[model samples]
Target: MATPGTAKRMWALDSPTFTVDKSLLLLGASGECTIPMPAFLIEHPKGLVLFDTGLVPAAATDPEGVYGPLAEHLGLSFLPEQTVDAQLEALGYKLSDIKYVIASHTHFDHTGGLYLFPDAQFYVGEGDMRFGFWPDPAGAGFFRQADIEPLRGRNVLEVPGVDHDVFGDGSVVILFTPGHTPGELSLLVRLPGRNFILTGDTVHLRDALTTIAPMPHDADTVQSLRSIRRLNLLRDSADATIWISHDPEDWAEFKHAPNCFE
Candidate 1:
């Protein structure tokens, strides 16, 4: 394999959406905002990998049923065809073709398609699954029981709170930048022409990159800030583009599936 940044490698799955207050995406911001929830698929030379599954397929018709009160609050706009499995099939791949599932974290948005990959190897940060089950407190609503329940008998390979090179060639990496959730993670993909740091809720909007701020609900504000700073350093030093996954602005910037990153 000569390397594939030229083409035929990675693609962005179409996004579903959920509307929330601007304040939800960034600290001290306001107004209602609709954001994109994108998923990614990578056809690595060695194997197939997926990053961040969007909303539950059921959410398209029954958001309230799938997500409870939170769905009503967030206002979902998902299409049945926007699901991971459907998108993969559209692209001529199958559910079983995904050899690896790299979950940026177990937030409901990122874990929706995990059930499709029970036979594939799973990768997540150390505290993520644990946090998904225990959560922060008496009623932390982000962790959905349905999302975590399916992992019971699956193969999950947790990376101890640190950065990891997924393929050993430095093409894909898992950066441990927890804050939004206890084991929140971000992905770093080094395509031949460009590099991308997929910020998985580490900083929900591009504004956070400039302000260096953490959203109000993060598990550790201090750690969140530090992670932002680290990402900034990486952005500058490596000339990497930080793709804020939920940023609507970002959704417009990249081409959806059928179109690809590299």
Candidate 2:
């Protein structure tokens, strides 16, 4: 924690690279394409806040160890330096500095590094916990047992639909934007120059937001559309930027850690 009025600094962390079906990003699409798995480091005045954890480190050396066959199916790949610890170290920080972790959802890619931060307060949406405890088989192998196990009985804050104000400063707020998963969450971060809304799979790409194309893995198509519309309204109302989590185009426009948004 810095000071009460002190503004927070945000850094976009490096993530694993993977390819997925075009239709998986935008419905009714064909073929495959590359995407980035991003994590964020927020130097809040109260404490360090991390948004999502990207991929598991084991996936770097042994993809099969972390994700089983799904790792191969998605063509997941990464270097050891891209792991969360390495990314933090590259930014002149360490895993111990993180005070709170905001998980967008329980999907393998987003929650992979949670095991590394047991002492950090974990924030997640209420409904998503069920998926973590007993993942529905119909999710098409999106949620993983190994990833969810680490978060079982820790200091978990199950944020309800009302949304959560991370530091009570209205700077870094967790918005409950479901549909990608039962309790999918997004972020509303107020930086010095710009306000950013990190949409965690709430419409995998910007095109899906414009086209209102429901992703194939979306838990509820109608709810997904509503969430996208809600984000669009918020984006327009505040003139904020929406960063789609898995969109490579969005990822390309930012600087990975060691550089930051203040």
Q: Provide the TM-score for each candidate, comma-separated.
A: 0.94, 0.95
Candidate 2 TM-score over all chains jointly: 0.95
Best model number under lDDT:
2
**Model 2 whole-model lDDT (C-alpha atoms):** 0.85
Off by over 4 Å in 2: 1-7
Q: Could you tell me which 10 consecutive residues in candidate 1 have the lowest summed lDDT? A: 1-10
Which residue segments of model 1 deviate by more than 4 Å? Answer: 1-8
Residue lDDT tens for model 1, 18-76: 88998877898998888988888877787888988777777877888888888877887
